[model samples]
Target: MPPTSPALRIEVRGVDATEPAVAPALRFLLRLEADAPIRALTLTTQIRIDATGRGYDEQARERLAELFGPPAAWGRNLSSLLWTQTVTHVPAFTGATTAPVTVPCTYDFDVAAAKYLHGLPDGEVPLRFLFTGTLFYAEEGRLQAAHLPWDTESAFRMPVEVWKELMDRHFPRTAWIRLERDTFDRLYAHRVRHTLLGWDDAVRSLLETSGG
Candidate 1:
């Protein structure tokens, strides 16, 4: 007879920003439920943004057009976008257990996930987590291992306010943008020539000069 594998279920409980970290990070609490005793487990999670899971206002549609194209073509353009992947270790547990999954967040506007997150006005961000890995358990008085099934997945609706507040706490009225070295040199020179107190002033002056 084939060995029976343990069926594990995972759920996202909540999300919060980790304090005193060198980089921006969000921690996800995952609750794992299992009927059999799980000696140990390794979980790989693929996080995706379900773009079509929620409604979008006109303003949001306009902002996201660059990513998903025009609202008129949303049926074809909108789809789940891969956000990030993470691996977590689960210790021995019986019945149920919870683990903290720390996911790093990037503020760079060049990232599609970042742009999509920032573009949202207000509402919950629909997220889907695809889980797969290895599971260890005991059966017939002997230890055994089995592949964590691919069909295991979880969905969570994260409040936009949480993301916004996390960014505000870390950046506080500041936005990050990457520019080519030449462009940066030119901007630096302009700031020096104008004796600008900050980069903001230099950019503002250049915009005004160009009638932007």
Candidate 2:
């Protein structure tokens, strides 16, 4: 069901919802996937629906509770501080369904790959976060009714500092990146993105690289 009122749109702001707010680092990944600014997401329809007294907020709270529990797997305590090694900004070009969205993470990944290209210790390279999410626009504001997929994953044994530089240069709009405490060391490969890569040639590259 689309939003009953254009103003009564639904939005899921990616955040650190676990234990004292999800880790800022993980929250950063979610923020990158959001359609609007992190803060605006929660109050998307607040002023518009406030006058109607529809209890939209309450309903949203419940819906979010259910969605976040499964959709978002990263708990709190994840954060990042940018430290650059060698960074470069390049245009992100990708698309799916006739929508052209930039694949900034690809640039970040390629940039981060420099270290490995140069041959650096696995641990010396910083962790890489390529969290990707898509927001569907169906009719009006019924975000809940739309089907948007979320994919979060990382590359490990990487030099941490180098990854930050890559993100800073290619994907600054994204927020902090930090090491997961448990260190699930093996390359925790997930189809994560800083933004939704349209299902096009650009996305094809990812699939090809992943052997999809």
Candidate 3:
């Protein structure tokens, strides 16, 4: 519950003027270490700055606080979350400040993600939000680890970009849906004609493998 070490700013080096809005996310992607821990200097999700930190959006802090709990609050930051999850971090200062510990972070995508997706709101979300990475997961309302990483493709066999965009445009509110016969048939036909991979065969294999 140690407030992400009082959310502070540090003069980071090697960060380009144009970096991904999510630095940690970029770090994970660029490195992609099997279980390597990562550290980066970026705007704190907990600290609210009047000035936008370079490429970071001004509202990122507020938005994150609203979606997740207050990460800056004494007991609600990532440090506390990681502690609860038993992910170890090295206590080292960086860029004139001590940030989240640098350690090899592990992401067990398959297990943790299956849990998160089962409960997320089924709604029209921007397709841009979709990406392949380990998302933070705290279960039983308890933070589980540094994160539960997932290759969005391997984790979910669905063509998420296409599906999400379609749903966002077409099905804004409905959930638990089964595509109509005509629609499914059309999609299946399109898959057969365009993509060499047989949708039915691949899907059937996945279903059988998962025991679904």
Candidate 4:
């Protein structure tokens, strides 16, 4: 008879931002434990921001108004935000092992997760890491494969400062926004006509002109 697969457990140790590079990213440290030796592990993780798990101050609530509406209506409006989904390969190990799951990040505020993250002024961000994948092990002399249980998951409360630090490392004290080509053309023309020193000057001019 074939042997039954051993149970596995997953835990999130911590999270941090990657060093300055062409693209920004966050690395989540994961610890995997098993009753038996694992030949290899193909891990897939879906990370989510539990927006409703943490309390928000008045300032944060106002900042997040666009996403969750006003604080008065938050009970019905707030929901989890999907941060990212990524896959990683875990090397062979016995008992327990640690691995990093790197998730690429973006400064684009158009993304809901980014918008939600940027809205927070302080405190931790409640995160849920849902794990699913295949595990390979040895039985007798032959190798065996099995699917990780559906219930495999971990919870983490990552400090908002971690994300803010990463962004500050890459962007300094600046923010990014996207504009349509036509809109950009108009803004560029205005900049050139008005001899604006920089993009910020051009945008500030338009905002003042429109009384925004």
Candidate 5:
């Protein structure tokens, strides 16, 4: 009789702010299980926000209007949002092992993921993880490699506070936004022309002038 191929399973246990809190990032704890000993693993994960999996508050719905249109149309417009893709190398393990999947975060409002996250109020952020990779193992004293199943996936509801805390640690009270070079040049000229002490003053002056 022939030996059966090994199978793998993955689960997300929890999430936390990265250690040292030096930058904006989050770490997802993953439990990896296999029927047979795994010599090595090259894992690729695609993290997505299941936008429709959870409910949103009125404020959140209003804020997210730019992304999903009016709340009335959200029934059809809301869909999964691709957050990020990360790759990690898992060390040798016999039956089960734990790994950390670190995801870097940005505060730039120009980024859709950031905007979506910021729009949310207090609640868990529905997340989906899609995984595909290659695994290496010993078969009869010979090195063997196998491709992971295409259906490997997991779901997790990450707290919005975790992301907010991470950003606060790195950026304090400041937020970031990107602008076109031409626009920046014009803003800079306006700032200089008005002898504004800071960018905030220049922007506020413009907003007031425009009746914003």
Candidate 6:
């Protein structure tokens, strides 16, 4: 009879935002265990935001209209949103092991994931991680390879504060906006014509004119 493959399990132990030493990133601690020795692991993780996992206050719902349409249509619109895909290697281990998943985040409002995360007022962000990859192991003194089970997954409720802290460290009391080349040229021209001391003043002036 052929050697049976070992069943693998994964769990999200904890999360933390990197500081100046490791700026602009969030790291997740994953604990993995298996019945047999794992020679090597190449893990592909798909991170998703479960919009329906948490309740949103009235104010938060209003702020999230752009992403989910309106509160009334939430039942249909509030599905999981793919945040990012990351691949990390796990070193050889026996029985159990812990690994770190470093996810680089962006504060650009143009991105849907960024917008959704920024719109949240408070509370934990529900995250679902789907994993897939190849697993290497040794059976009866012979090396072997097997496909990771399709149902391998993990759920984590990451605190919003972690993300907020990361952004604050990278951009204190500021935000990022990406503009088209033409739009930027027009804004620059207006600033020069108005003798605006800085980009902030030029933007404030435009906002005032538009009653924003």
The local lDDT score (0 to 100) that residue 56 gets in candidate 2 is 22
State each model's CA lDDT, in order. Answer: 0.93, 0.29, 0.29, 0.92, 0.92, 0.92
Best by TM-score: 4
TM-score of 2: 0.17
| lDDT, candidate 4, 42-152, per-residue tens | 999999999989999999999999999988899999999999999999999999999999988888999999998899999999999999999999998779999999989
lDDT of 1 by residue, 47-91 (tens): 999999999999999989889999899989999888899999999
Question: Model 6 segments beyond 4 Å from truth?
Answer: 19-23
lDDT of 3 by residue, 55-76 (tens): 2223444444433345345144
> Which digits, one per residue and each the tens of the lDDT, describe model 6 over residues 19-83?
55455989999999999999999999999999899999999999899999988999889888989
Candidate that beats the other on lDDT, 2 or 5, i.e. the better one: 5
Global lDDT of model 2: 0.29
Where's the lowest-lDDT run of ten residues in candidate 6? 16-25
- RMSD per candidate (Å) reads 1.3, 22.9, 18.2, 1.2, 1.4, 1.3
Stretches > 4 Å off in candidate 2 = 1-134, 138-147, 150-157, 160-212
Off by over 4 Å in 4: none
Supply candidate 5's per-residue lDDT for 57: 83
Candidate 1 stretches greater than 4 Å from native: none
Per-candidate TM-scores read 0.95, 0.17, 0.18, 0.96, 0.95, 0.95
lDDT of 3 at 109: 26
User: Positional deviation of 102 in candidate 6, in angstroms?
Assistant: 0.6
